[model samples]
Target: MSKERSSRILHGFISACLVAAVAAFIILAIPDHLGRAGIGAGSATKKNFPSAKNLSSIVDLEKEKQAAEVKIENPSGQLAYFKPEQVPIPPGQDAQAQDLTLTDPNQSPDVAGGSGAAVDDSSFGNAVPIEPEPTETFQGVPDNFVPVAEDTPRGSSITLVTYPRSSLAIHEPPAHVLRRSKKEYSWIFTPPELEKDVAFWKAIYSRYDKNQVVLHHPIYLDIIYDVVDLGYIEGDMRLSELEKQHKKEKLIEEKRERIVSILEMLAQNQRLSSSLNDEEWRIKKLFDNVGDPKKFQRAAEEFGVRAQIGQRDKFIAGLKYSGRYLGEIERIYEESGMPRELSRLIFVESMFNLKAKSSVGASGIWQFMPQTGKLYLRMNKIVDERNDPIAATHASIKLLRHNYNELGTWPLAINAYNAGRGRLKQAVQTLGTKDIAKIVKNFKHRAYGFASRNFFPEYLAALEVAENPEKYFGPISYDDPLRFEMVRTAYHISLPSVAGVSGIPLEELLELNPGFSSKVISGDQLIPIAYPIKVPEGKGSIFIAAAARAPKSQRGSIRHVVAPNETVNSIAWMYGIDPTRIRQANANIRRNPSKGEIIVIPFD
Candidate 1:
């Protein structure tokens, strides 16, 4: 066979296939063409399927495509077929549904089927559901948002939070309270205007990348009143005590913020001596640093910061104590090859009264609180080394050493000792400079806490008076460092019991056991077995031996609780009694009880 002849034969076959496909489709869809024009060929009547020629002439494909689908369920029955065409979209709606779709609704008699089947009477158990459009009039939005044309996509449902951006600022209030009373008329007062303006003002301030003033539009003066807080003045702030100093501090803060505000207002109003950016930068830097920029500006404009804080003997005393401690500390000063007199800091802190307790619960000559003392010193039911000068001094030294290791500066270390290290570090970081005065004025940061703010100045002042005590106090007596003998008990014991046995005063015994409390020392717990036992200079060994026995009168051993800053020997001698007798009475009196308590005092 020739190749050209074979190619022609293939083309003829393709043409024949296309023509047959068209004819077959027309023959199948004849019934659907008849039904939509108010006629049905594939109706219940059997004759509807044959010769449905009138339906084929009026068919419109585009209109049929635009119509929505319809579902028709048929129960078990004889096969039926129907054909319809040109189904239009329903009135006031885009489309309608048809029950069924068939490739050929009206077909030749050999094919038995109905294109759009009707639901049977027995098949009524199943139902189809249709959804309706939602109803909500969303106000404040562009109104022409409905879907009108066919095939248009639906838009998203509107919601409250998803509303426009410009509506954010006034959407809700921070807080509100409502009250109803039978005794009075209904009344409503809005929140004071002050906080709103301040927050808004801060928002304005935040707009600048490295400067301020982006937009400026003021409401009434009343709105400005909302931003200002004069209540901080306390209205009737007292001028006595430290009140004057406090008022000055508060005023300084106000003036500082005002300075920033003024510079911003001036630059924005075009009333400045330099570029707006320059003024802004200066104001912001001043805001970030210590001292009131406003005050500094005023001072620069007027005179200068020439005021002095007048000399105070108390301040001198504190500095002197600091110097004294610098010369005599045990672990940090002596052991670390540092100055020994540094031990005098403890004296400045608690006036060398081992039993002194501060308002904050700080105790001992070192003024270590209960928890802090517990950490470094052995403090138990029978022993608290914080009262003992040698023991507490060692603990203080160790504590200072730890602080120094963490913070290189001795001044900062001292600050950390009084104020916790965390607060000191926070203040240092906030001020960008480790200036003590700056830390004092930071009301927001914990660095401004009463104790922490005062700690540095108080410590420095302690050093001053310690150097020359006689200058402040007339010829202050020199009390020698106390001494004691090491006495070991074979069993559990109380000071009063020991006093009764030895005919020694309980107060005397208590003075020796300065580190103990509860008078009852258990045999098991860690306690000074050979604790420093003080006795009269001429007392014999027989007296000490006799006091070692436990007795009832001595069981509830008592010691004169020497008031703060009182001397143990002085109290003992005051009662015309031996000091050893008191020590024996209260075996557990750790540190001398400065606030005098009943003690086993000997007769004169």
Candidate 2:
């Protein structure tokens, strides 16, 4: 063959070879492309499969599809389909789990074929095992899984599932530890030896009303002869006050006479048991411990019947009012290292009455007489700290501490608060015993009356009632604690001026600072310099600032000499002030001021 013909044959053969190679490449690539498109049935190669990132997204999509197919079996054993979002997240999972679309990988279409043929997952390695769904029923979901309301929309109603309460763990904050007291006063205050007397006083304070009078022996308080109902006497408004008083005295005297008669009859007749009345039998039962035949006579003569006025209403009132100052009083006693229970003695003395005053010059809630009060309290024409609850509390603490120091026992010290300290000391010396129970039983002095003898027991009873008021008087709505800030006067200032400066009502200032006398409250006199006065809470600094800004001339009393014919109205008109202001400034002044007498005109 020629060289050109040979070359042409070689080129045709080369073209045929290239065409055959391209056909083989097309045949190989078509299978891979079809396999990747999931069209033909063949195991997908590692390269044909998705990348790691794409594989994650595919798994998530498969999971969401499988989750939609999964059904939760409630307590009724009925399969219920819930949205993946509606499913409660398991306890160990975070809040992000609420948004997660969960599914069973074993049921995923990617891992298992929809035609029920298992796909080989050896390339992806072993699959993660799914946890079993929780089957616990919740509070609102019933065991039978009935719909809550007939009107509830079908398939729209959701039944909440929760873990059993027993399986739930609750975490509480640790409790704060408090300081324990070193000493206890229970035995000293509520001694078993004096329980009978204390109980008697407790009955008087709680069980009986103001109209009831308990008649009992002076020494043996448990020996209650009778309880006289004086309610009838009180209800008789038609009777004059004098007539009512006389009628009550007569009734009490008649009862006394009858009791004496019974005792005398019992003493004279040994065979009186057959005809004895119900009251006589009760009285006879009380004397069963006595061995002497003439005991009735001795009792009639020595065991004089004493009457105690019931204080239940007063006690209840005291309890309600006590809330205002109880916290502060307790704090004061605690700070002084004294028995805080002693502060309840005010309930016994004056029933927490701030305006309490005794006929014998005793005053305030503490009942401090003039002689005793003068030592620790400030009492003068311009101010009386005795009427001030806070100031009086301090004074009472000092006096009580002093008494305790001198008397060496709380019983004697408390008694000294009512009776004179000298008298209690004398009784201790005479009795030759410091035991209050023994002193109460045997020691008898003419001066140491029923009140002095029963003082300690009354205190114990008051303490018990005050501590547990709900037991005596059911549920009390107490006054809120007094809120104020104490400030000392920088200068002698009138109350009206203080009110003007601090922007507090004049009446409120007067109420808070009860230590200020009428003269001080009015413009007749000025609040003394350095004297502590109570202002509304958070107003102390404001008062100080305002007082500093006030002119010196307007701060103190503005006095005027009365002309010969000057009346209160005329003097008020002359000063261009109110007549009422003049009267308030000069409380002692009546309709007219005496000639040449000094009168005060209130200045704003």
Best by lDDT: 2
lDDT per prediction? 0.39, 0.60
Task: Give stretches of model 1 more than 4 Å off.
Answer: 1-332, 434-444, 521-532, 536-540, 547-604
Candidate 2 per-residue lDDT over residues 95-180, each given as its tens digit: 56433322211111111011111111101111111221232111121122211122121221122111111000111111111233
Q: Report the error of model 1 at residue 348, Å.
A: 3.6
Candidate 1 lDDT, 339-450, residue by residue in tens? 3335546644765554577897777678877767755554434445566554566667778778767766665677788877776777677677654444544524534454
Give me the candidate number with maximum TM-score.
2
Q: How does residue 559 of candidate 1 score in lDDT? A: 28
Error of 1 at 145 (Å): 99
How large is the C-alpha RMSD of every model relative to the true structure? 44.0, 32.0
Each candidate structure's TM-score, on Cα atoms with residue i matched to residue i, is: 0.37, 0.57
lDDT comparing candidate 1 with the true structure: 0.39
Candidate 2, superposed: residue stretches over 4 Å from native: 1-183, 236-250, 290-295, 485-491, 494-507, 521-524, 535-604
lDDT of 2 at 475: 78
